[model samples]
Target: MTEQRQDPILIVGGGMAGALLALLLRHHGASAVTLVESHPLTLPDEPPLTPSFDARSTALSAGTLSVLDELGLAEAIREHAAAIDTVHVSRRSRLGITRLRASEEGVPALGAVVENRWLGFVLLRALYADAAIQVLAPERLSAIRRLADGYEATLESGRTLTTPLLIAADGAKSRTREWLGVSARDSDTGHDAMIANLSLASDHQGIAYERFLNDGPLALLPLPDRRFGLVWTGPRDQVDAWMEMESGALLKQLQQQCPAEAPRITGIGERQRYPLILTHACAQAVPFGVVVGNAAHTLHPVAGQGFNLTVRDLVQLACTVGGASAPGKLSLLQQYVQRREQDQALISQASRWVPEMFRVQQPLFAHSRQLGLVAMDILPGLRQGFARRAMGL
Candidate 1:
């Protein structure tokens, strides 16, 4: 019988973040890395339908795309992604509109949007191709015992293994984080998001639209083949009602709410909805275990900052621990959390603030919000700063 060998690093979760972290670690020459996931890994011909990489789509910031380029996965992604040449922000029945353009920012493109399934497929292919990564799906980390050097983990199948480093990329309701005694603060945004693919009557021309309506913000992100990925947010009951509406009625409602500049909504695909909640872990690292991705922080989708921020965290963490002699050192993990504190705080605040700022129906606040959008348009420096942040620069 072949004996099970101890791995230097063990990552729990095989979603986008977890899988990408394994790839990044391998890219940085980290060997003997084992990834444990509860979900079954999909076949090469089938796109993964994991919770993180289901029918939903994601906007990849320029910074993230750059990281992918370094990892040599950008070309595969670019084939399916639609560039974001401009981001147009407007308020319903308001007098102000702001457009942040990639040309003005002196970049090729601000970002791009790709289906999460394809992204997952790319990562899975890379993981399987790398001999250094040991992917164990259809498996679960049942328990962990803290050791002086790291952790001793037991799997559901009664297999035992030890790793010097443990990472919790299991997502927002991370069992690994809980096992490590990390507490999370979850704030319900009082809103739910309905997402689906949209077919437009006209070309989107690579323009992403953010229209703030009375109920909630609606984002129509450009996608290939004259389609857009829709993130429509509102109260749970309202969204549920919309979910039940006939396609034609729903499209009509979207047309009424969307900005006139956006392409007409031609058709809608299967829709899914979930409550919007902002969650932040009280602490990011514990002794030898570290929390990453949605396990550490889950932000609102209003600004599309959630996954992008997670990618940044993964990159920094990989750079910090990859190829290190003591990969699971507590001090090193703490340092990784420290370096990410500012970025995490800022993006979380912004994600929360955007929706609240627009939710207020008061006259003075409305006027101020309108003026703010106008200012962002007229002031090059102001818009540039915002653009840079949004692009993850």
Candidate 2:
């Protein structure tokens, strides 16, 4: 593709990754960056009916936290984020427990949790205020054409735009990725993750718990305002049953599984469920563009590694393409893909294997799992390394 200095960079998704990518590009001195979103570009004074604008939370690691500076987001996320000082991992009905402490690693906190709506508010507010970034709302990509000099996209609203570089920042099911003819490797876990908010009877004390239960992995994250965020992964039938169960019954079940010292789960918030799948785009780049975020590699929410890894690559990509005369050149895009190999592969394997090993019913596997946790706790170096990686350091 030929270079055109005046042609703007088009990003196809206004979600966290897409919006943040636009900001990052701008940080790299890109003159014009455009973000196309499927939902209405405008957020009314009253809350809108968007899934992202909800009580559901996003876990932000110390590493992913750099997105604020990298993307030129001036607002502080601390007030909206609940600090995670420690993460206590365990196996239900087992005698294994390991604690990952931020203090032990010489970091102030391991990570932080912020509600999706709050994060969206901050990000969108910045996007709308920035004149360099153009946002097209209530529009979707209907068709794409690969040009000798670049690429062309026609939106559902009949709006046409062309640029030398087009990025697919759309979510897991990315239409842009499809248009680019990039194939993704997907694995269904045969489990569904049910998410909701939990009102705690006692303060969480800045601790998050990841428990391996018979059904699957259950994670309860500490939140601000004396609450907790639950990501309960289990078989479809069990998840469906839990979703229909009364709040009191659900509370009782959670209390039974929770740590003795943990505060009683008194109230439940809106419950939403989605199938768990691991997706990785076989090809991240081709002439004239590349795919990123969930579209490039949709990961299990095991350690909340999905967005952290994506953000890292976004930063690298901005640097790689920032001053290059031909940003859409194949060689430059290949370099970006090469730089991400190690982290992506390692995290993907961990997210897939951890659940399987813990979920096994065999006594041998169970004992081995317990031993692993014990080793992780006893070995200081191992523990520190894990803590650092988990915090996205």
Candidate 3:
């Protein structure tokens, strides 16, 4: 029998964030990393509605691309990536249209969008190829017992692993964070997001759209092949009716909410429903456990900032853990919290308001914001700052 290890660093998820963390740690020369996930690890060429990876797409900020490049994982998935050269923002029934071009920002591109499944495949490939990492899936973290110097994790399959540190990358409803008794403040945005890969009549031309309606902001992000990844965030109760509507009728509703010149939704992939909620964990780390990714802070996809924020947390955590002799040390955890507190607070604040800035219902308030949008277009410095911040600067 193989010897049972007591000090391997155990990561408790195998999603993008978790897998990326293991790879980052290995790149930093940290070893003996083990990742456990409740979902299946093997993603078929046609992925299903799995927890880790599916057809849902994400817009990776330019800064995130740089991180992926630095970690040597970008090229592997470049073929599946589509650049965003322009962003067009407008409110329904308003003449004020704001455009931010990558050329104005002095960057190669604002960002890129990639299907989550492709990202999952790429991360999994890199993870499996690394000898220092052990990938475990179809297994779930059920319980944890924190020790003075380490912690022991019990899986649903009765397998046990003890490690000096534990990372909770287990999505929003993380059992690991609950095991550590971490409390969070979660605010439901009173909205539900209907996401799918949508084929449009007009090509995106590497352009993204943020069209503000009476209800909420609707983002049409560019995907390959004249398709756009749709994030139709609507009222919670009405989303079910919208999802069930015939394609033509639903496309009509979508077109009504977008600009008069917007593309028509021709076809769509499987629609996945997600309740938009913003979460902030009061405690990020304990003696031998730490939370990262959506588990640490789940944000609204208003600005598509959820993954970007999580990536930063993962990168910083990996670097901090790499330099520390003890990954579970309180000093290291405290430093991580202190370093991230400001950015977390700032981004959370900005995300909350950015969505509201587009609500065009009341005539007076709508006009005020329309004027604000016009100002954003006219002021180069202000627009550049907003663009830079949105690109995860």
* The candidate that achieves the highest TM-score relative to the unseen native structure: 1
Per-residue CA lDDT of candidate 1, range 85-191, in tens? 99999999998999999999999999999999999999999889888888899798899998888899999999998888899999999999998889999999788
Q: lDDT tens string, model 3, 1-393?
A: 995444678898888789889988877657679999887787446442457587688999998988899988888767888999998998877778889999999999998999898888888877878887888877888778877788888888898988888988888888788888898778888889999788888777898898887777789999888899999888888889888988778877777777766677788777889998878787998887898888888877887888888788778888888646688887898888888888788888888887776664677987888887899999999899889988987
What is the TM-score of candidate 2? 0.96
**Number of the predicted model whose lDDT against the real structure is largest:** 1
lDDT (10s digit) by residue, model 2, range 6-61: 67888998887887788788788777888988887576464333544565688888
Runs in model 3 lying further than 4 Å from the true structure: 1-6, 43-49
Deviation in Å, model 3, residue 317 alpha carbon: 0.9
Ranking by lDDT: 1, 2, 3
Q: State in Å the error of residue 279, model 3.
A: 1.9
lDDT of 1 at 144: 95
**Weakest 10 consecutive residues of candidate 1 by summed lDDT:** 3-12
lDDT of 3: 0.83
How do all the candidates rank in terms of TM-score, highest first?
Answer: 1, 2, 3
Clashes of each: 0, 0, 0
